[model samples]
Target: MIDALYVAETGLQAGQKHIDTISNNMANLNTTAYKKGRIEFRDLVVGREVTSLDETGKRDLVSIGNGTQISRVWKEFQSGDLKATENPLDLAIRGGGFFEVLLENGEVAYTRNGAMKVDEDGYLGTLTGYRFSDMIQIPPDAKELEISQDGTVTAYFDNDSLEIGQIQLAGFMNAQGLDSIGQGIYVANDESGNAIYSDAGENGIGILQQGYLESSNVDLVKELVELVTAQRGYQACSHVIRAADEIMQITNDLRG
Candidate 1:
C-alpha cells in the first residue's frame, strides 16, 4: 500500500506537468511565430530482480515499474501560417531560418517574430528594439520602402531607388535544441550547434516575405484533446491513491 501511494504520487506529478505544457501552448496560440511545446514521458522502473528459476533452469527476471515521469519538453519547430499585414515592415520567413538580432548586451539572439520597426537612429529593429544583426539602416527621408524575397532592402527618393543593406538569416543544426528565453527569442547552445549565417534564400535558408507575419503554430484542437487526457490521467492517479489509503485503513481496523 505504501508503494502504491508513492507510485500514484509520481503519476500525479507527471500528469500535472503534462497539463501545464498543454496550457502554455494554448496561451500562446495568438502569439506571433510562437512554437508549441511537446512533452515526452518515460516509465520509471524502480528495480529488477530474478524471481525464480524456470523448468529449463533459466532465471526469470521481474522488473518493477514505479510510475511515469516527464522525460523532456521540446518545442515543435514546424512552420506556421503566414498572415498578410500589408505593412512593408512586417516580414515572414517562407521556410527554415531565424532572424538574427543584436541584443543590448552585445550578444546575438535568434527569433522568428518579424514585426520590425525603425528605431530613432533609422536602424531597422524589432518592435521591442532589438536591432538587426546586419545593422540595416533606413534613410530618414526615404520612401516606398521595400524588401525583396531575397532580403534586399530598397527605397525610392527623388524618383530614384536606393539600395539599403541586405537582411541576413541564421540557421541551426538542431533548432529544437535552442534555448528559448521568452518573447519568441532563442539563444544558441552546445546542443543547438553554432549559428550558421546565410543570405536570405541561399544555402538552404528561407526567403523573406515582406508585408506578412508568421502566426503562432499552436493547434487549438490538439491542445484541447491533450488537456482532456491529462485531466483524466490525474484523476485516475488520485483514485489509486485513495484506494491504497482506504485499504490500509481497513487492515488497521481489523488488527485493532
Candidate 2:
C-alpha cells in the first residue's frame, strides 16, 4: 500500500513538472528570439522496498519495479521565421545562428534579435543599444549605409565612397549545452564546448538580414493541447491515490 502511494505521488510530481514547462513556454510566447524547452523523464528502481535483509549483496533475492524520475529538460534552438518590418535597423538570421552582443559584465551574450541601430557616436548596436563585439563607427557626416546579407557593413560618405567592416557571429561546438541568461541572451559553458568563430553564411552560421526581426515560434494552440494532456495525466495519478486510500480504508474496517 505504501509503495503504491509512493508511485502515485511520484507520478503526480512528474506531471506537475510537465505542466510547469508548458506554462513557461506559454509565458515566453512573445519573447524575442525565444527558444522552447522540453522535458525528459525516466524510471528505475531506486532501492530495496521489500524486507529481505540481505544486509549483504550476497543473500536474498528481491525484485523491484521501476519508479519515476525526470532525466533532463533542454532548450531547442531551432530558428523562427524572419518577419519583415522595413525598419532600417531591424535584422534577422535567415538560417541557423545567433547574434553576438557584448555584455557590461565583460561577457559575451548571444541572441537572435537582429533589430540594430546606430547611436549618436555612429556605433552599431542592437535595438536595445548594446554594442556588437566591435563598435562600428560611422561618420556622423556619412550620407548612406548598406549592410550585406553576408554581414559586411558599408557606409557611403559625402565623397560617394564606401568603407567596409565585418560583423561577427559566435558558434558553439555544442550549442545545446549553452545556458540561457534571459532577455534572449545565451552564455556558453564548458559543456557547451568552445565557440567556433566564423563569418555569417559560412560554416553553417547563417546569413544576416537588415530591417527584420525573428518571430516567436511558439504556437499557442499546440501548447494548449499539451497543457490539457498534462492536466489529464495529473488527474489520473490523483485517481490512483484515491483508489489506494479507499483500499486502505477497507482494510482497516476488516481489521475491526
The predictions' CA RMSDs to the true structure, in order, are 2.1, 3.0
Q: For model 2, how many clashes?
A: 3
- Give lDDT per model, in order: 0.93, 0.80
Q: Please, what are the lDDT tens digits per residue for candidate 2 over residues 113-134?
A: 7778887777888777677886
Predicted candidate 1 versus true structure: per-residue lDDT over 1-256, tens digit per residue: 9999999999999999999999999999999999999989999985555868889898876779888999988899899999999999999999999999988899999999999999999999999889999898889889779999988999889789999889989999999999998899999999899999888899988899999999999999989998999999999999999999999999999999
Candidate 2 segments whose C-alpha is farther than 4 A from its true place: 47-63, 119-121
Q: Estimate TM-scores for all models.
A: 0.93, 0.86
Off by over 4 Å in 1: 48-62
Among all candidates shown, the one with the greatest lDDT: 1
